[model samples]
Target chain A: MPSPLRDLREQIIRAASVAGEGHIASAFSILDILWVLYHGILRHDPGNPSDPARDRFVLSKGHASLGIYGILAQRGFFPMDELKTFASSSGRLGGHPDSRKVPGVEASTGSLGHGMPMAAGMALGLKIRESASRVVCIVGDGECNEGAVWEAALLAAHHKLGNFTCVVDFNHSGDRALMLGDLAGKFRSFGWEVTEIDGHDHAQIEAVLKPHGGDVPRAVIANTIKGRGCTDMENNPAWHHKAPKADELEAVLAQLT
Target chain B: MRRQFVTTMERQLDEDPRTVILLGDIGVFAFRNAFKKHPKRIINIGILEQATVSVAAGLAKEGFIPLFHSIAPFVVERAFEQIKVDFGYQALGGHFVTVGGSYDYAALGCSHHCPGDVGLMQAVPGMQIIVPGHPAEFDALMTQTFASGKPAYHRLSERSNREARCVTFGKAEVVQSGGGPVIVTVGPFLDRVIEAAGGSDATILYYTTLAPFDAETLRQHAGDGRILCVEPFYEGTLAASITSALRGKRIALSSMGVPRKFLTDYGHASYHDAACGLMATDIRARLDELSHV
Candidate 1:
């Protein structure tokens, strides 16, 4: 495992430990994609987070907030010290991301199936204004159960919002309830240009994050494990919402790399 | 009123560059000329009401004023969560102009009926509810609120009052004031309320905006603490605001509007009005009873 990626996982674990509550496995599932997005893909300035020409990214699956918080902090959107205040009443970082309180957060989202449609709307608005700004929305594979997700898919396709991109974190977390079979085919049938990739690969993620220059929107289905690096947490439903207790913290940290 | 809405919105599209209209596969022909002139601004965005609202919120976030047009039930009831979360929670400003509220689509049965829109919207914090009684009033309210930077619901109806009263955003207009039970009418129910209180010395207050309820106006003219509220939508919709406005005073409040139940029978709006006891004669009887009390 790469040292930087392992370090990020450690940061996520420590933050969750301090908060004593978080969707740790869920955060682990999308950490690489978020890291790649903030590092290379999204054209956002940490200092000027509300730049008119900056690209917009909406975390439709906002329960994995620890992942984005770590990335944003690493990118200097806020100080790294704020991570300790996660889920505390005194902190701006809640279990879900709030755009108003956080500098780089574009949309406030916690309830599933909201961010994609909002991203489609932002993409449509940018297209109308003839601006170069783009919008990227990430949704959990489990979140696809919502009717609003498909509604947004249809809308983005119908409007031919070329500036929009939807990334699905296919961690198979939702398989226990309902299986989303053939996601790429479903997106293609909905008129989106579909691409499937290993979500943990930084190079693979970076390649598909650029403009495709098409009339229709793009969908990247990112295949990922629920907890990628940690042995005890990987694809473990028990770890889905659990933070490490003080006694178990050392053992979990040892498994990160 | 829908015609006036089209003309008024057409003029707005021409005058304001930031104005945008998103239709839910309804009122496309009415906006044909405006679409030709500003095709990018005027869009029939299909029948997906939930997506339309989120899309409007997105546009609002980008500094563009977006108006979503559709039937009341589809716009307000079906896409309510989107309006609540996307617009209200996000603090984004947009406009929702809906038709066929109450029993306006009475012939279409329960599937198309939405009497709980105002009640539903009132639950959302910072939501502005506007029920226009006349075409001119619709035009007036739409002009003032389209760019006000708040989520405003402009509910239009097929019915209209005989004359246009002086309309304000949050303030109520006093149509007739006398030393009698205060009769407050909302939107197009003004004329019927007036007829119900004819030959009596009753105070009539007309309300267009229901969210920032004109409690001050009601408090000023709530004579003898006897108040009768006649609304075109659900009954007792204004009960909380009325009671809250005059909390300390002893008051007898009676409400007459659409009953909170499904009207299974298929008929026009007038027939439904009669079924709900909203006709002038019915209201007059209620007014008389209130006066005697």
Candidate 2:
């Protein structure tokens, strides 16, 4: 079997190849968080899709959908073979995750600034049901431009949803590398207990998540490298979604080796 | 009406823990005392309309019935994505109570006027649009909406009006039956149409159920003559429904309320008949013209 990290990288490539468009940098940046959540931390069952107690995860940064799609394919939510349908007209996958179309997808998301409140809602539901399950979300640092995100951030704390955790994939870059500014501190202003971390370190993510309970809603600002783990494409905007022509693909593949 | 809505919900919550009530800063209205009564169940979700409906959808997937309420335009227009994706895509049972069926905020002008809610909301699948005519219909619709157990948008008036006699959820309410002209009224504006027609002089068809309409009632009431419809807002409301169901079987179904084009007009009339289009005078004049044929 391919290593989980390696499998994720290939899935990202495959998903982009199928759709022919993607936020490649953001997708790669959140790869480790997606890996650690699905493989090591979150409790879920691939076999039974509707288990009430399963920990829920919302890819709130839905532009980076390939990460979640890649993990779902690996977990056998559908089949690994179905990745071929990603973002095609006849496909179950779209540019973002649509829960109605895909099994094991907790909620439909593509509209950024909208998913976290739904995540908070899911967390609220778990609490109302008196279940021990938690709700987790992966959001993008740049997507904080939306006013709705702050509303949700304030709501998450106001509700006292300690069972909910948000991980912000902070690539320190934007469509133009300028935004509303100071995203990690912005989370603090919204009353989130914030932590900044190295997103590429799987061990750091694993070590930080060992504790289950907390009093406040937590935010992990995972400082990541856009186009991470790639050699020449590491910070190149051209590779954001451009299909690496044969030579570049080979070069990218060689770095993984 | 808010009391009726929340009390009915309270009854449902007592039976099933999954029933939830979400208000978008709509506490000044009544019956949602349930929020204070049961803190876990009733949530004043503040003014964020977009997040409110998305969160409702999330709560619904967890097997809860979410009753969402707010001003007409903000609740429906602001959170359209949430409504379309969360509720419409999934067809979850959500009771969306949107106040201000028409120009209730006469002075608030364009932003507050929800001329497009019913028509827009009606286009969504499994979404039942309700324009209850009076307090009685409001109470009945509240009970029936829960019993129907489906996604619905109920547009209620901010002020109470002359109470209509009867209200059936999916069944059409036949107000004043007569042979010449049939006035199909939506929301509390039905009272104006009934009054304008000089009591039992003309037939009035009050629509408490905007969609999944009692086509049989429309077919029976709307035969071989002009049927006048009075509503608070635009052509999108019940006009499309009547058009779709009846289909080219023209009985001269002219809508009474709201301008067909962009209404740059302002001010809330105690009733919107002639000013907004659904006045009995307009209906009477139209019937006169249609009777010529």
Candidate 3:
């Protein structure tokens, strides 16, 4: 069932491995979600990142920089070769996503708890302007501790914004520790239709990609590992930040390939 | 001050469709008419001050100039992170108009009335702080801030300050003229310094912009005399930023504002102003004491 897109998870990890750079594990966790959005879901023209009709994908949990950058490259939004500059200076890739620098990025978000509200605002802006472009806000389960997340969730649901969909990368670890891991119930409490699924399973992710039962904004809680792909990095919080040694890179790429 | 900001916001909404004004369940009176003129442009996000700020940040992210109006203590204090993360990190077009700067709601109790609203938010990257001295300065500052495509905090005092010479952005008003002593004042509370220093040998100036105030401008007006500062809001940053600019000069500096702790004991208007030494006589005594030291 795994295809060329499935293989991209290995390629992205390989790029970061080559440079010994990036939050590799965090990126590895949300690969399927990004893959589905870029390849199948998003209505975009790669030539125009600012194309008004294009749907937006906000990396609210922006620390997972590797996942988004890899998707952009694989989708031809940028040169696949450019991904070698993952976390290096002079590279467009920041430790967090920078919308101003990154072509396909909608907004810059590295600080926790900010991404969703802006996404909700964009969704509302599109509604007021009568644009049909949908907005996908990728949030971290742990990052949900921010009270603004709930506030935005309420706004989205109350407005019955079906054009907006939020996917929580329920990787069980924020920068420090596990955030509220119960995604479905939390979203339920905040009045969102919740869907729980395996994050890495492409079929599982695609099945739930449809709009919610009603006009309420939906939150898909994708259960994922922190560092998912490489054997050495899986579930390892030590790999939360980048410091992959050269030999370590060779080893990771070998296993991934 | 609140009415002027609201009126100007309504004017901008008519002038530019890109402008959106959000009130945090506090300033409904100001935007009631705007709802009729531009219903889509105005939002009343009830009671949730933090959400109100982030919602504005969202609107700003999409190239809309959003004016976030709320009382000083609640707007800045409660929603500090939303301001920092949403607008500060991303560099959005959100203007936080904090009405009621100093002891505006002295009678409303402790949670509402303590100074330091602007200082708490000033150091955040990309956030510019503005404190309007009088009604005239309020309009000028509001127009200039909206024109600039950046994040700003316009700190407006609640009291109907005694009208002085009109002030422009970044220009402090020299209320009382004297060479021996110069007391730099900010916000609408300059009325106190005018009363205290009017008959004395002291010069009083109402400083306009708290953030980008050309320190060189303040330094020029601050030499060969005792430089006493009257900050009706938090003393830490406003007074510190000015005094820091005057370092190594022979100008002796003294600062007065509400102490860090929230003062609990409720009192009459005179008691609140004098106790914090926002009153001109209290300021005079501090200057008199500093001279002895």
- Sorted on lDDT, best first, the list reads 1, 3, 2
lDDT of 2 by residue, A96-204 (tens): 7888778788888877877788888888887878779888888777777667778888888888888888888788666475664667788888888888789989888
Compared with the true structure, what per-residue lDDT tens digits does model 1 show for residues B137-201? 99999888888888999999999999998899999999999998999899999999988888999
**Cα displacement (Å) at residue B131, model 1:** 0.3
Supply candidate 1's per-residue lDDT for B67.
Answer: 94
For the candidates in turn, chain A alone yields TM-scores of 0.98, 0.91, 0.91
Indicate the docking level reached by candidate 2: medium
lDDT of 3 by residue, A1-257 (tens): 55565467666776676667677778888887888777677888889888888888899888788788888887778998887787778788777888778889887888777788888888877766777778888988777888878888888887777778999998888636644646689789888888889998888887787544456788999999877766777888788877566666666665552
**lDDT for A215 (candidate 1):** 81
* Per-residue lDDT of model 3, residues B209-259, tens digit only: 777666876777775747777777666556667667788776577777777
Candidates 1 and 3 compared: the better one by lDDT is 1
Q: How high is the TM-score of chain B in model 3? A: 0.91
Model 3: clashing residue pairs?
B116-B234
Off by over 4 Å in 1: none
In terms of DockQ, the best-performing candidate is: 1
Q: What DockQ does each candidate score versus the true complex, computed on alpha carbons?
A: 0.80, 0.65, 0.59
